[model samples]
Target chain A: MNAIEVKDVSVYYGNLCAIRDVNLNVKEKEFLGIIGPNGAGKSTLLKVILGLIKPVSGEVRIFGKDLKETNKILGYIPQTSGFDRNFPINVLDVVLMGRLKNRLSLFHRYAKEDMEIVTDLLDKLGLSDVRDRQIGQLSGGQLQRVLIARALAIEPKIILLDEPTASIDANSRSQIYSLLKELNEEMTIVVVTHDLAAVSAYFDSIACLNKELHYHGDKELDEETVEKIYGCPVELIAHGVPHRVFKVHEEGYDD
Target chain B: MIEAFLQYVFLQRAVYSAVLASIVCGIIGTIIIEKKLVMMSGGIAHTSFGGIGMGFFLKIEPIIGALIFSVLTAIGITTVRRRTNTNSDTLIGIFWAMGMALGILFIAFTPGYPPDISSYLFGDILTVTELDLKIMIALTGLVIFVIVALFNYWKAYLFDEEFSSVIGIKTIFLEYFLFVLIALAIVALIRVVGIILVIALLTIPPAIAKLFTFDLKKMILYAIFLGIVFSFLGLWISYQFNIASGASIILLAGLTYIAAVIIKRS
Candidate 1:
């Protein structure tokens, strides 16, 4: 069974259609990248799959189970920009929230095993040094890593990330990409981003979306295909590597 | 001093009730402040005025009426907040005025309204009864117990609502639970501090405690300690000056908050 099955889904906010008639199926352990311009409903699609937003129409199924019924099995890393960086909480405490479901009762103590799991996840994320530091004190990149660590603490079957590297520096962005790539080896990963250039090289498959599904396939997309998806001509500019730039056909202006 | 302490059982009851109420208020106040629901507490306290009026009309226990009205309003506020796109604070303000107006109408209709509306307006700690003491103890115990039991849930609730929901923490349930707890605390406090001054107690102590600590747990403890100290000092000042005890207590807490703000700014 497909790990995530979204069939003919449309989402609307009031009269404005966020996403229209999008259908896609993600197989197990697949690294799927969702790319589009701003307001293209990329995050909306992820939220719909995560069951945070109800689609105006169509159904989403995870592991053959309905989306609404599979919340516990899904780990979501929402856009970091939406979070309050000054929120007063510690790193370990933030991660331990992921284990709340497994606790027997409200009063139940955190088991040694639970602590060990949290500690291990922090170490893996290279955040063990700031385990006791308040979340407010962390830098943007550190905060993003902490959020990822929180998602990992759930031991989810699939992970959904929305703009994980939007505001971080290049070095941190690459590190996050490498970490996500490694995680994809063991879990189904779905990333929603507008950073098409760097992402095309990292993602196994690309789902180009703009309110509707422009393209959905696993093969490496060439410049013409990306330009078609973006409605412009494409240029391969070197930003360390040859990065594809979607150029406007009329003015030859890179977008 | 010994004679003054023993001369009035009512004064003794006031001290006992204030200590218990302060403790409960201190802990719950921290949550309310952190959750950014200080205005909601004010709304709940004002809404309880309708309950107070109802109790006066029926010649029944006003605290029961206060609890019912406050909890129902809490539920209503929570429901409206979830189902609609309207700003919650606006809804709360509208209800606050409506409740106050209803309370006045009810009191006017009642024959021979109690001359001691001041107690409901500004708490008369000296007039606390044995039943009031029992109720305070029970409610305080229950509030503390729930807070301790739901430590992880409360922590998650405070940290991030969306993240907590994504991780399957039952965000709605926890939020409603908090609303109910706050409603209970408001009801219990109505008799000790009166509705007018109750919001002060709920906000000031926690705001003052915030200045001293960054840790949430430590902040709550400090708030509780400060709440108790302010309660006693306010009660003493009220006695000495023959003023309203509840208002005096709130004034003390408010001053402390102001002082803390100044200190932090400097």
Candidate 2:
């Protein structure tokens, strides 16, 4: 069964079509990467899948259930650049927020079980040392890890991340990708990012998008598809390493 | 000061108003600052002036009018801010100007001589009646009840609204609810510091508290304590110097905010 199914989704921001007639499907436990240029509605598409933005037309299904009914199983990590670092909250509290229920009760408390899960997640993410420190005190790398821990605290079947490694250092970026690779063993992972190098290296499948999904399925990105998405002549984004380089179409290109 | 309180009911009511206002302002102000809604709050506070004017025109309790106007304005601001691409500050500025204009119009249309609006404009803590005290008590209690009941939810909602919505936390409803709370807090504060200076009380104490603590709960507690101290000091200064109580209180808070910043820096 597919982990996510987006059918005929069209989103508009004040009559400007953001994502138009987008159809996508992700298999369970598949690591998917969504790449697009700036202003390509990449974030908008992610928001639509998360049920944060209402599409003008179409439906999203998660494990054969409607998106609205299946929100509890969806964990999200938003762009860290947009976060308020000065917010008066600690790592423990931020992660514990993932344990919140949507019940209609006046008084709610975090149970002992919730604390245990948060503690274990903090330990797993190597964030136990900064559990009590305010979010503003953490480094860029640590903040990204903390957000990841928060997302994992929900024990989600499908976890989504938006620009999880946009501004962090290369070492931290590599660490995050490898961590996601490890977690992909148990749950479906979807990421929207501009990091083409990392996407080629880690993602099981890649989707190139520009106002609409231009290509989907497999990690092989042809030059024509890249041009269709970016609308410009691009340079060598993929480097030859243990990872597969792009199947070069030009005669003089080296592996 | 002790003898004065014993001799005067007005002085006693003033102190009660101060303490009650402190509790509400401390909690809500922290939220307003954290959410970066200070300008919106100031806009809401100013718009309530229209309600006060409407009250005078219709021969009704001005605070009730202020409450209605403030709440309506909050809903309006929240809806427009969320649904439209209009610049937030531009929307707030319009509301602020329109509210004051409406107030002026309402007062002009009233048949009788203009009422002495100084108390509503600036504030007269000594003018607080028993009914005003009762209103303050009820409002303070309501504020505390709502906050306590939804403490954790509020923490999540304020931190990351989009993520909260993705997690099924009803971010839209929470935003509207928070705006209404801000309106209520502003109304409760009207009789104490008047509309113009209400934002000062709402923002200053919390700003001071933020400098010392990073915990939301501790920030509230410290803001409450700081609010009480500042109100008392301002009250005493107003009494001793024969100045406007509202201005004195704002001045004191502003000075203390500067001092706190300096102290924290070094």
Give the number of the best model, judged by TM-score: 2
**Candidate 2, B72: how far from true, in Å?**
1.3
Docking class of 2: medium
True contacts kept of each: 0.48, 0.63
Q: lDDT tens digits, residues B1-266, model 2?
A: 99999999999999999899999999999999999999999999999999999999999988889999999999999999888899989999999999999999998988889987788878878889998899899989999999889999999988888877777888888889999999999999998898899999999999999999999989999999999998899889988888888888889999999999999999
Task: Assess the local accuracy of residue A202 in candidate 2 as a C-alpha lDDT between 0 and 100.
Answer: 90
* Residue B176 lDDT in candidate 1: 86
- Residue B82 Cα positional deviation in candidate 2, in Å, after optimal superposition: 3.4
| DockQ, all candidates in order | 0.50, 0.72
User: Model 2, which residues run further than 4 Å from truth?
Assistant: A236-243, A249-255
Clashing pairs in 2: none
Which candidate tops DockQ? Answer: 2
N/CA/C clash count, model 2: 0
| Cα misplacement distance, residue A206 of candidate 1 (Å) | 2.3
lDDT over C-alpha atoms for residue B125 of model 2: 84
Best by lDDT: 2
